[model samples]
Target chain A: MTPQLEILITVVIVSSACAALGVFLILRKMAMMTDAISHTILLGIVIAFFITKSLTSPFLIIGAACMGVFTVYLTEMLKRTRLMAEDSAIGIVFPFLFSIAIILITKYAGNTHLDVDSVLLGELVFVPFDRLVVFGRDIGAKSLYVMGTILLINMLFIAVFYKELKLATFDAALASVLGFSPVFIHYALMGLVSITAVGAFESVGSILVIAFMIGPPVTAYMLTDQLKKMLILSILIGIVNAIVGYWISAILDVSIAGSIATIIGITYLFAFIFAPKRGILAMIHLRRVQQIEYAVKSLLFHLYNHEGTDIEKEESNRHSIYKHLHWDKRFLERVLKKAARRDYLSVNKEYLKLTPEGRKYAIKSYEVL
Target chain B: MMFLESLLRDYTLQIVALGSVILGAVSGILGSFAVLRKQSLLGDAVSHAALPGIAFVFLLTGVKKTEMLLLGALISGLIGAFIIISIDRYTRIKFDSALGLILSSFFGLGLVLLTYIQKRPNANQAGLETFIFGQASTLLKRDVYIMIALGGIILLVVGLFWKELKLFCFDCEFGKSIGFSDTKINLILSSITVLAIIIGLQSVGVILMSALLISPGVAARQWTDKLSCMVILASVFGMVSGVVGTLISSSVAHMPTGPVIVMVISVIMFFSLLFATKRGILWRYIKTRRDSRDINECKILINLYESALNHEEVRHAHKTTMLKPIKSLHYLRDKGYIRRDYLNTWVITDLGMEKARNSIDKNRGERV
Candidate 1:
C-alpha cells in the first residue's frame, strides 16, 4: 500500500481508540487528567529510552503507562490531603515532570535523534515511514498495529465490565454497597486511558491526543442522553474528524494536529447550536417565537371579549388601546395581519369585525388567559 | 558555599531573583482567593488564553515592549474569562467543560499565530517564544522594579479588601444579603488575578504561571485553616521557591528558570501533602488506623458480652471463663475497665459496666 493510505489508516485506528476510551474520561470529568498524562508521558518515554537505549523498545509503552498511573495516584493522594483540589494537583505535578523531561533532553539528548519536540509532538506525515517487519516481510505502519491492539483491548474491557463501569461512574457510593468495587473499576478505566494515550501519542502527537479524547466524547454527550448512543456518536465523530481534518490540512497546507483539533472544535460548536433538545440557539428561538405567538393571540382575544364597549370602536382605536397596554406598534400590526389570515378578524380602513368562528376562538383564549 | 556566593554576585542573576520574588508574592496573594473560590484552574486557562492576545498585538503594531504586549494580554485574558463565565451561566455545560474549551482554543490560536510570526523576517520575535516557557535569567533591573511596584500595589489592594474578599469567596449569597455587591467584589478579585498573571508571565510564562499561583496556596492551605495566615504562608512559600529556582537556574548553565521554579513549588506542595499537621496524607492515615483499632476493640468487648450471655450456669452472665478471649479481658482489666477474681474468672467493674452500657446506648442512638 502507499504511504498516504497507511497514514490515513493509522490516523483512523488511533483516533478511534482515543475516542473509545475518551467516553469514560469525559464522564468522570478527567479530561484535564488526559492532558496531564500526555505531557508526563514524555518524561516516561525519555527515561525509558535512556534505560533501553532504543526508541523502538517495548518498554516505552510500559514506562509511559506507569507514569500515567502515577499521575492519577498523585492526584488522588493530593486530593485526600485536603490541601489541594484535583486540578491544582494536576497543575503542579505534570509540569514538573515535563520540565524534568525537557531538562534531560537539553542536557543529554540534545545531539541525539530523540528530543523533547519529537516526543511531545510526533510527525503524523512521517508515521507511515516507520514500518514494522515480521520475519523479513514488510508490514503496515508500526503505529497502526500498536493502536489497533490497544483499541481491541479497550473494547474487550468495556464489553466485559460495562454494567460495573456504568454503575460506578454514575454513583460510586451506591455501587460499593451493591458488592461492586468502585476502586477496581476506577483503576481499570484509568489503565485503559493510559495505554490509549501512549498508543495515540505515537501517531497524532500529545496536543491532538487530548482533542481526540475529549472533543468527540463531550460533543457526543451534548447530542445524546443515552450512554450507548453517546458511544456510537463519539466513534462516528472521531472517524469523521480524522478523515476531514486530514484532507483539510493537506489542502490548506497547515499543521495536521492543529487542523484536526480545529475541526473537532467546530464540530462541538455545531452540536452546541443545532442539537434538537439542548441546542442553545434552538431554545432561544423557541422561546422568542412562543412569546410572539402568545402576544398576538392575547391581543386578538381582548379585542373580541371587551365587556363594556363596542368591539368595532375598540378595534378602530387600536392605538388608544396600545397606549394602555404599552405594546409596540409593529407587534400590533403583525398580530392584526395574523388574525386576518386565520379568519379571526377582518380589517378595513382601521375598522374590524369578528366572524362566529373568531368569536368562539376568542372566548376560548379569553378563558385560558 | 563559595561557588553559590560567586553565582549570586552576578548582576543579572541578582536582578532575576529579585524580580521572581516580587512576582511570586503577588501570585500567592491573588491565588489564595482563586483557590478558595474553587476557580484555581481559571488562572491556568486565562494565562493560556492570553497567548492569542499577545500574538495579535504583535501582528498589528510590530511592537515588543513588555507593557504594550501585557496590556493586550490582559484584555484578551479578561475576554477569555468572560467567555468562560458566560458559557457556564448560559449553557448546560459544566465549568470544567467551558474551561477546557477556552483553554484549548485560545492556546491553539496563539500557536498558529506564533508559527506564522516565526516564518517572518522579524528578529525581535526571538524572545516571544520565551513566553511559552519562561526564562528569568534575561530579566533586567527595570523588570525587577516593575515587578516590585506591581506586587506592592496588588498586596495593598488585597489587604484593604481582605474582609470583603473573605465574605465573597466563602459565601457570595450571604455577602449579598449583608449589603455587599457580589458583582463589584468579583470584578476586584478577577482584576487582581489578571494583574498577577501579567506580572508573573514575564517570570514564569503562561503555562507554568498557574502552577506558581496554585501550588503555594495549596501548600499553605495544608498548614493552616485561617485565610489570613494561609495567605502569608503561601507568599513565603512562593518567595522561597522563586529565590531557589532562580539561584539554581543561574548557577547551572542552560537551565530554563520557569520549570525549575515550578518544580520547586511542587516540592513544597509535596511536603505539605505528606507532613502538614492539620490536613495531610500522613495524618489521615494515622487517624484512620487508630479509628480502626478502636472499632476492633469495641467489637471484641461486644463479643465477650454475647458469649457470657450464652453461659448456662450464670443467669445474668456476670462472669466469663479464662481463655484466649480472657487474655484480652485481662488486658482491658489492666487498663482499669475489668476486674479478675480469685476463681480465675472475669467480671466487669463498675466503670467497665458503665462504659459497656454507654457504648450500647450510643450505637442504638446512632442507628435510630
Candidate 2:
C-alpha cells in the first residue's frame, strides 16, 4: 500500500477510536476531561518510557492510561474538597502535570527522537515511516497497528458494556442502585480514553486528539437524539473528517492534524447553523412563524370582538386598525394580507370583516388565553 | 550569593526575570477573578485563540514585532471570548463544551497559518512557534518593557474596579438589581484578562499560560477566604513561581523556563493543599483527631462515674472492662478527672464527674 493510504488508514483508525469513546465522554459532560486526559497522559508516557527504556513497550500505554485516570482522580479530589470547582480543578491539575512532563522531556529526552515538539505539534507524515513488523514480515505503519488495536479495544469495551454504559451515563444513581457501578464505568472509560490518547498522541498531537475526540461526537449529538444513531453518525463523521482533512492538508501543504481540526470545526459550525430541528436557522424560523401566527390571531380577534357596532365599522378598517394596533404600515399590511390570504378575514375597500371560521379561531384563542 | 549578584549584574537576565514576575503578578490577579467566575478554562481558549491573530498580523504586516503581535493576540483572544459568549447564550451547548469548541477550532486555524508561514522563504518565522510552547529564553529587553507596561495597566484596572469586580464575581444578579451596568463591568474585566494573557504569551506561551493563570489562584485559595486577600496572595504566589521557575531553569541545563515555572507553582499549590491554615488537609485531619479523642475521654469519664455511684462500698475497686475505656480512664486520671482509691478502685473525681456531665449534655444536644 502507498504511504498515503497508510497515513489515511492511521488517521481513520485514530479518529474512529476517539469518536467511539468520545460518545460517552460527551454524553457524560466529560468532554473537557478528554482534553485534560490528552494532555496529562503525556506525563504517563514519559514516566513509562523512563521505566521501560523503550518507546514501543506496552508499558507506555499502561502508564499513560494510569496517568489519565490519575488526572481525573486528582481533579475529582480537588473538587471534592469543595474549594475547587470543576473547571478550575481540571485547569490546575493537567497543566501542572503536562508541564512536568514537558520539563522532563526537555531535560532528559532532548537528544532523543521523542521531544516536546513531537508531542505538541504532531507529525502525521512521519507516521508512515515507522512500520510494524510481525515475524519478520512488514505489515503497515506502526501507528496503524497500534491505533487499530486500540480501536478494537474501544469497540469491544463499548459493545460489551453498551447497556451498562448507557444507563450509567444517563443516570448514574439508578445505574449504581441496579448493580452497575458508575464510578467503575467512569474510570474504565477514562482508562480507555487514556490508551486512545496515548495511541493517537504521536500521530495526531494532543490538541487534534481533543479536536477529534470532542468534535465528531458533539457534532453528531447536535444532529440526532438516538444513541445508536449518534454513535454511527459520529463514526461516519470521523471517517469523512479524516479523508477530507488529509486532502486539504495535502493541497495546502500544511499540518495534517491542524487541517483535520479545522475541518472538524467547520463541520460543527455547519451543524450549529443548519441542523434541522435544533439548529440556529431552524430555531429562527420557528420563532418567526410563531410570531406571525400570533399577530394574525390578534388581528382576527380584534375584528371579531367589535363586529356590528357603529364605532367598530371605523375601528375595523385597514387605516383605523393600523392606528389601533400601532403597527408600522408595512407590518400592518403584511399581517392583514396574511389574514386575508388565510381566509380568516375579508377586506373590502374600507372595512374588514372576520369570516365564520375566523370568529371560531378568535374565540378559541381568547378562551385559551 | 553569587547567583543573586550575577542576576543583578546581567541586564538580560534581570529583564527576563522582571518580565516573568510582572507576567505572573498580572495573570495571577486576573486568574483569581476568572477562577471565581468559573471561567478558568476561558484562559485556555483565549490563549489558543490568540495564535491565529498573531499569525494573521505577522502575515499581513510581515513583521515579528512583539507589540504588534501582542496587539493582534489581544484582538483574537477577545474575539474568541465573544464566540464563547454567543455559543453559550444562543445554544443548548454548555459552557464547557462551548469553551472546548472555540479553543480547538481557533488553535487549528492558528496552526495552519503558522505552517503556511513556515513554508515561505525569508519569513523569519523562527520565533513564531515559540508562542505555542513558549520560549522564555528568547525574551528581549524591549519585550520586557512591553510586559511591564501592560502588567501595570492590568493591575491598575483591577485595583480601580476592585469593588465592582468583587460584586461582579460573587453576584452578578445582585449587581444588576442594584442598577450597576453588568455589561460594562464584564467588558472591562474580560479585556483586562485578555491583556494579561497577551503579556504572558511570550514567556509562558499558549499551552501553559492557563496554568500560570489558574495555579496561583488555586494555591492562594487554600490560604484565605476573603477575595481581597486571595487576590493579593495569588499575586504573591504567581510572582514567586515566576521568579523561582526562571532561576531554576537558568541554573539547570536544558530546562524550559515556562514549564519549570508551572512546576514551581504546582509545588506551591501542593504545599498549600496540605498545610494552609484554615482549609489545609493537615489542619482538618488534626481537628478531627482531637475531637474524637475528646469524645472518647468524655465517654470513659461518664462510664467511671456510673460505676462509682453503683458501688456499695466506696473502697471497692471497679476494673474497666473495655480496652478503649481503660485507655480513656488512664487519660482521665492524668488530667485529674478520675482517682485510684485504696483498693485500686477507680473513682470519679468531682472535676471528672462535672466534665462527664458536660460531655454527655453536649452529645445529647448535638443529636437533637
Candidate 2, DockQ score (0 to 1): 0.54
- Going through the candidates in order, state the TM-score of chain A alone for each one: 0.80, 0.91
- Model 1 ranges with Cα > 4 A deviation: A1-9, A81-84, A133-141, A148-185, A243-253, A286-369, B1-8, B121-124, B149-164, B172-191, B252-255, B285-368
* Residue pairs of candidate 1 with colliding backbone atoms: none
Strongest candidate by lDDT: 2
Cα displacement (Å) at residue A130, model 2: 1.4
List candidate 2 stretches off by more than 4 Å.
A285-369, B176-187, B298-319, B322-324, B331-368
In order of appearance, the predictions have TM-scores of: 0.79, 0.88
TM-score of 2: 0.88
How do the residues A203-227 of candidate 1 rate in per-residue lDDT, one tens digit apiece?
7777678778887887898888888
Per-residue lDDT of B1-368 in model 1, one digit per residue for the tens? 85468555777777888888888788887777888887888888788778878887897788788777888888888887876776666566667766766676566556556656666776468788677667787777877776777678788889899999999878889999989987678777777787788888887788778888888888888889899998999999999988888887777876778888888888998898888895788888898978876665566566555555576643233445433455566567777666666666665556665676678789999999
Docking class of 1: acceptable
Question: DockQ of each model against the real complex?
Answer: 0.28, 0.54
- In model 1, the number of clashes is 0
